[model samples]
Target chain A: MELFMPLFIAVVLVFGLIKKVPIFDAFTDGARDGIKTMLSIAPTLVGLIVAVDMLKASGATDMLCGFISPAAKQLGFPEELVPMILLRPVSGGGSTALLTNIYKTCGPDSFAGICASILAGSTETTFYAIAVYYGSVGIKKVRHTLLAALSADFTAAVMAVVCAKLLIKI
Target chain B: MMNLIFAAMIIIAVVCACVTGKGSELAQGVIDGAAESIQLLITMSGMMLLWSGIMEIARRGGFTAIIGRLLSPVLRRLFKKLPKDSKALCCISMNVSANLLGLGNAATPFGISAMKELKKLSPHSDKASDEMVLFVLINTASIQIMPTMVGTLRQIYGSREPFAILPGVWISSVCALAVGLTIAKLFCKNGGS
Candidate 1:
C-alpha cells in the first residue's frame, strides 16, 4: 500500500510533467487548493460525523438492525448484512465501524460472504449522495433525483448480496 | 430552511475566515497555518491526477468503449427508449467508468451530469421517466470490477496478492446490477407512481 501510494503519485507527476505545466508551483497550488476545499467541507463532514456517532451511540443502529434483519433474511441476505445495508444509507463511517465489528466477529477470509458484505458497505449512500450533491449544487429539481438515487442504492444492495452468495466461490 | 443551508455555510466560512485581533508579529502564526496543509493537498491532487490518468487511459485506449460495446447488448434492451447517442448514455458510461476504478469522488460529477441529461428527457421535471428510472437502476447497481479502496486497504495490511478478491467482487457486482435492473424494469411498468 505504501508502495502503491508513491507509484500512484509518480504516475501523476509524470503525467503533469508531460502536460508541460510547472511542477513545484502546480503541486503547491494543488495542495493549497485541497486545503481550501477541505476547509469548506470541514463543517459538513464534522457535523455528519457527530450526527452518525450520536446515532450509533444512541442505539439507532440496533433499532435499524431489529427492523431490517428479518426482512434481510427473507431477501436472502445474511443477518450480518442487515447492519451494512441499514447503516450505509445512514453513515459511511458508521458503516465502516460496523464492518470492523463484523470483521472482528467473523474474520476477513470468512471469504466470499465477508467480501460481499464489505462491498456493499463501500457503496455510496444513494439518498445521502443526492441530498449532499444536489444541496451543494443548489438544485430544486430533487424529487426525481431522490427517487433515482434511492432506487439505485436499493438495487445495488440486493445485487451485492446475491453476487456474494452465489457468484464468487471464495 | 433549505436556502438557510447556504446562509449557514456562508456564515461558517466567514467566521472561519476571520481571526486576527492579536499583534502583527503574533498574527503571523495565523496565516502560517494554511501552509502546512499544502503537503496533504499535494498528495490529494496527485492521487486524483493518477486516477484521472487511469480513466483517460481506459477511455482513450478503448477500454471504456470495449466495455460499453460488451454492455450494449443488454443496455439496448434495458434502455430501449433512450437514443443511441443520448447524453444520458454518455453520463452512464462516465459514471460506470469512474465506479470501475473505485473513484467514487470522481464519479459524482458524472452521475450528476447524467441526471441532468436524463432530466432533459423527463416529462414533468417532477417525475422520473421510465428511462430515467432504469438508468438510475443500472447505474446504481453498476457492477464493479476492481475494488480499489478495499484492495488498497488489504495491500496496506500486507495481504498476499491484495486483489485476490477480484472474482468475488466481479460476481457480486454483476449479480447485484442485473437483479436491480430487472426489478427496476418490472417496477417501472406496474408500480411507478
Candidate 2:
C-alpha cells in the first residue's frame, strides 16, 4: 500500500500533464500558496510547543498524571495518558510530548503505550481543529459541530481502551 | 531558557526513572524518541506540502469542481441543510476528500475555505448553524481510508506490516461515519425543532 503512494502521485501528475494541461505552472502556484499556509501555521505550532514545554516545566504535567492515574488504571490506560488526553483540546505536539512520556514509562511495546498510540491516531483534536479551520474562513455557525466531533472522540477513547485491553492482549 | 529547563527535567526524569526502574524505559524512550518524532514531523510536513500542492492544482485545473459535481448528489444526501451551490459545499467536499485519502494536513485549508463559505450563508454572527455543525462532525469523523498518522507511526516503529491496520481502520471508520452522521442528524433535528 505504501508503495502505491508514489505511483499514485505520478499518475495524478501524468494525467494532469497529458491532458494538454499546464502542469508546471499549476504545481508552482500550489506550492507558493502552500508555503503561505505553512507560514501561518508555523508560529502557532511553535507557540503550542513552547506552552506545552512550559506546562511540563511547571509540574502541571505531573499533577495531571497524578489525577488521571487512577482513571488510567481503572480504564487500563497508562497513567501518562492523562496529559495526552488533556492536551488534545490544546495542541497535537503537546499531546505528543505526553505520549512520549507514556511510552517512556510503560515501555513502548506495552499495552499502555500502544493504547496511547491508538488514542493519538484515533481521535481528532476537536476544538482545536474547529478553531483553526473556522478561524481561517471566519466561520461561526459550525460551533455546534464540536458536539458531534467530541462524541466521536469519546467513543474512540473508550473503544481504544477496551480494544487495547482485548486485542493487544490477543 | 524554557526549552533548556524542559530538557533538564526530561534528562533528570530519565535518570531517576532508570535508576528506580520506575518507568525509566519510557523516560529513556523519550530520549531515544526525540529524533524520530522530529524526523517524522519533517516527513509528514513534506507529504503535507505535496498534498497541498496537489489540491491546489486540482482546484486550478477544475478537477476539484469535477469532483464536487460527481459528489454533489451524494453530498446533498449527507448534507441537507447546506445548499448545493454554496462555497461551503466545495470546501466541505475538499475537506472530506482530503481526509478520506489520509491527507489531513492538506485538508485544513479546504476545511477553512468551506467554513468561510458556510459563514456567508449563515444568519448568525457568533454561533454556528446546524449545517456547519454537521460538516464539522463529518469532517472530524472523516472515514479515513489511509490513516496517515498511524501509518507514519508504524513506519517509524519499523513495522513491516504498516498497512495491516487497514481492516481495523475501515471497520472503525465506517462505523463512526454511519453512527456519527446519524446521531448528528437526529440531534440537530431534535434540538432545532
Q: Candidate 2 lDDT, tens digit per residue, B1-193?
A: 3355446545655455545555634544444454544554565566456656665555555565566567778887876777667677777887777666555666777887777777788777677767777777766664665555555445555545544445444544455556666667776744642
- Per-prediction fnat values? 0.08, 0.26
The C-alpha stretches of model 2 lying farther than 4 A from their native spots are A1-70, A100-110, A133-143, A162-170, B1-71, B83-87, B102-109, B173-180, B189-193
Docking class of 2: acceptable
lDDT of each: 0.52, 0.61
lDDT of 1 at A127: 51
Residue B86's lDDT within candidate 1 is: 79
Q: Give the per-prediction TM-score of chain B.
A: 0.63, 0.67
For A1-170, candidate 1 gives per-residue lDDT tens digits of 33554565565566556666466655554445444544554444444333333333334444656787787668677666665665565554445444544444455445433544446533655556545444443455443444444554665566566555553454
Which prediction has the highest DockQ against the true structure? 2
User: What is residue B94's positional error in candidate 1, in angstroms?
Assistant: 3.3
Q: Per-residue CA lDDT of candidate 1, range B70-127, in tens?
A: 7666666666777888778777776766666554555678877877777777666555
